[model samples]
Target: MSYQTTETIQRLWDDFLRESLAEVPPEQRQQFAQQFEDRFSELLQNAANGGGDGFLDLVGFGDKGPVEFENLPYPYVQPDFDDSVVPSQLHAAAELYYIYQHERMKIFKVVDVLLKLFRLGKMRIQRGPGARALYLVEKWKPLRYGVRDRMIAYRRAFNYGSSKAPAGAVTNVNFHRQLVGLIVAVAQYFRDLQVSEVIRGGPMINQRPFGSSATVQRLGIDLRYALDRSTYGNIFALTMEVGHYLNSILKLLDAPDIKKAFDANTKWNVIEVVSNRYLGGTAEPSQRAKMAESGRRILKFVADNNFETSIDPHLFQTELRPIGPHAEAWLAAYRTTPEGQRFPGVPTALRSTRNRKSIPV
Candidate 1:
């Protein structure tokens, strides 16, 4: 299969920007174009060098480079759906529930990084958009119910007695959409910081004059160097996987049987009902609101920093320290987990049956 290259993706982005900015005045449009171009070009270069933007580059959708996607293992498939054995609505809910778990894990991973950064006092944002954003991130902690408790709720729901499940065991109707939105919001926030680093010219370095013969030279600091590259790379790959799982849930939800399971007019309604009943726990309106507000503030900061004025790179710098062992363990577990490894159906032993069927010449 033909793979997409940085050049191709760049052209597509350019065309998209032109159409998107058509309504803006010429001067503003030009500025917008330039900003996007610079950020996108840097992203492309990074992805080509095997450092992806956490989503686009890891899944064979990035620029062609030394890392080849052609040899990647065959994609994992979910279990085959059987409406008779399991209600379509229940199946869809279960899938969404699984994906939600993964999403939560990804969020926790990012929060873990940020928390470490906070504890080390390495990030230097005294006040401004970065400061406010960092404050919100530090304060943001989603409640995590015990796995056993959640599993019990799942069992009750599958048994068609979801109403009897414990409080806070079921998800709201808007769970998938809301969860994905939050994940993307957080992802973009970090992405903005990543982009800023690239924009400021990677790894601050001090240079000496060619003829200076100085015995010792001052070295420039790279904020990112404090964290392990593998750690960040894992986070990016995991985020990309979350997106793939989300797409799968959408497909499952769109099935005709799943749609017909609910009395509501649309498939979305089906999702809402299934998720609320089968997935445990009432929605936290207050927490959601807080998260939304925080997201808005950070995103606004990103927009201003991207187009108006850049955030100071110094604010993110910290004394070099290794990430916490718990964070490392979490990432390690994520890499080794076999939760999503099941194939949808039986697999053939050989790549092609045609070879076996052919007569000897």
Candidate 2:
């Protein structure tokens, strides 16, 4: 079945056709018009049916976007990876990196909250309660210890990487494993911190009452000052560094499934080049240059930090979880009940421990 052309496309084709056949004699113009309409109709039908796959190649057009290419010197073909590239466990690695990104954000949030308290305390200097809170924050240096302890905890989680990176050729898989280790440390660090009551209490210096607009505005200024300090500033800077590293590594380790149909030999693809440039919306040449330079810096940062020595892998192997009253009761019940009745979908077959030849409660 033939597909109908949209009014916009039909108008565009008509204009193009009129210009191309402008020199035709008046008597032959009727025939030319009929032929052009038939061909244009067929082209639209083909495009609608199968993306004009056969027609696109014949016309020397590669559809990266709305842009069109005509009468190219060579036919476009997609690029493929060289044989040197191998399949790796990238899925797991991506997940780990994401977790690291999340934890880094959490750490930032914790600091921001602590900083807010300082701002609030400073505002309440006239009040006895505010003065005492402010004094504690100044003397104790909780913010310093809070950030330091978390960073140390995270570093310890990847004990394997901390010792030394194993010497040999580094592959994509190896890079992923090392990145996983780095992020694991970060995730574990935040998870441990979250459960600590002491850190949560004065986490930002000490909790402050959420006040009206006037108080909040004053606190906001205080927040700026707190962030200006070296300790909090360093934490913020490290967060950005880690975020940039993750972004670069993920882009470098890319394994695209659906490749673009563009000629590998072609140095310049106008459509792709323009699209990438306008990715964050159209910008001036200066902004485009800045964007390019920023990308280079991120790549350099990743190159310097990727798969570096920092954490021990052994630390991630074991995790601690609290078995509170509810958990203890559930385990006791599971142990007493028949295996079949213990849980709805749990398997009856048991895996034994050293002391007992039975499934864990």
Candidate 3:
């Protein structure tokens, strides 16, 4: 039997989707979503799909560290392995880096919910090389410890690169282990809960890993993941959601200009450079070679719009719910839950610096 919290969470998730679907223009629904489905599919194939690269790469079982890239450029820069780079520009793309850095911790929390959903889907916890833990306490841990690139590895044990990094970077290889470690940690939580097991007629990993409308309602698992909760909310927050959100932002800002801007950038766009470097949207050079015509066009449109204004959720609506009794919705759904709620009794517009004052002392 599902818990009440789970049921409530699932309902909220489904309602959010239903509402979002209703708001979507009919023309944008069937055709435009094709690209999202394709991109999401690739994300699955590369990582979260049955033992895919997304999930397998982060096992961190034996030795955990970042994967060592042979052809890539500089492998090290800052201390504690802040592989995070400052973009040369500060438009939408640069904001992405800032968003990611700020929301790095929150990502872990959201990933935890996905693990639970996987369990509910009856998918076994994907085990990586060796048994290692992914945690950051006193100081910064390398990205390998809690993050994974978009692939699996037969590379170094525990480390993905050379342990001889130059004062910065992920201390050379084997970080794949760290990435894997996080996956395990997230899975372990649901395994312990016992509520993650698959129920009859429930969504299964192979057929439908992403809980369906009914499933999300029953489980109360919100799939939203926002970087800056103060700025945004649980609704429409993940990278994929960002793409959709950006589309909405453009329509609201300058719906007519969208086509014009995109037409001009048919060959290129600043967003292309930025998203490629940060948001990791659109397709890679390899994918571009094999992309279908529709896929190419969708990528082009997505790249052109960055949702510059009204990034704030309040401008839209309080998509993020309050965290509490119905919080099971959080474990199952991503951003649908309220686990990352900006503590109450504070100005919603507080900036990062001034934002600190709002946090109860």
Candidate 4:
């Protein structure tokens, strides 16, 4: 039998073998290598079947790269339904829903990016176009609290204090909230459409009122509707409108606030604060050393995963801080003049990078 593998997958396999040998005892190395290959091969098969580039995506390797402004690929830029062409209403609607579902993860990414920038004080909520940004922030507030509780639970599980929670502990929480928020938004939009069917004897044309999690689970059922062209167009338009609003809010962020927020005295970067708690605490010397090692590993994990990898502490300094320059550029571009308010082009696909720049704090 023949097998196929990409260069990246081959590289990953080689790296895995090398690392495993160093970690596993000589006597157990063979057994561990066999098990690792079996599981990795399975993931590789899944990736290959899904039109994936390679198994690199299964890890965080796909997103590891230079920091730049995060932009979502606009899915409605369909070749089949271009400006000259007119797709059937039902066809367009169904396609839009499918596209939204397929790109749902990117929507979550957008929310996560917004939240992180907001927390860093790089982005501020303006009055007009900032409404969507504010709405998302407000919706995420309770979710953030829930995440903090989960983190506290995690700390207790590890016999660690709340202050000593591992670096990047809240990452999973942010991911969960963003995913749920996206699902709820779509679900609510569909529910409003259904409600309009009875009262007005037609589909809802506007999406302003349906941005909540109340009907999220019903999204699966709502996907079955045979909507008209106008309805699909309306939904497509709404998606673009929301994207534009997000972009506008991001561009209008306050750079001064971001600089202030990131100041060393005020901002407690995960790497520095966590390391100090473990490496510089009153624990036994051996325990402190172990804790510091753990902290380093945690920072590497977060950086590889492309989440909260911005601040490079003295222990783990690198150029992965992508937010500062991007934020500065955005602030520079924001304009009060109508002609200067052009939105940047949305990415057509996920951006890739060959290297990452780490900023020293």
Query: At residue 185, what lDDT does model 3 achieve?
Result: 31
Best-matching candidate per TM-score:
1
| Candidate 4: clashing pairs of residues | 89-229, 318-358, 319-357, 319-358, 319-359, 320-357, 320-358
lDDT tens readout by residue for model 4, 1-361: 0123344456678886897689877656656666777776666555445533223433335564322222211112122211222334333332333223212213223445545555565554434443344455556442322324432432322222344544543212232232223233443344554575556632323312222323332322222121221232234443344435434433423223332433433212322332343334221222223323332232222223222221122112122223223222222222211222342331322111112366479
Model 2 spans > 4 angstroms off: 1-125, 142-149, 158-361
Ranking by lDDT: 1, 4, 2, 3
Reference-based TM-score of each model: 0.22, 0.16, 0.17, 0.18
| Clashes, model 3 | 46
Instruction: Give the lDDT of residue 210 in candidate 3.
Output: 23
Question: Which wins on lDDT, candidate 1 or candidate 3?
Answer: 1
Give the per-residue lDDT digits (tens) of candidate 1, residues 30-137.
457667766875665555445323234345464543345543222223222211122223223333244334333333233344345546764443454434444554
Residue-pair clashes per candidate, as listed? Answer: 7, 12, 46, 7
TM-score comparison, 2 vs 3, better candidate = 3
TM-score of 1: 0.22
Q: What lDDT score is found at residue 132 in candidate 2?
A: 46
The alpha-carbon deviation from the true structure for residue 61 of candidate 2, after best TM-score superposition, in angstroms, is 91
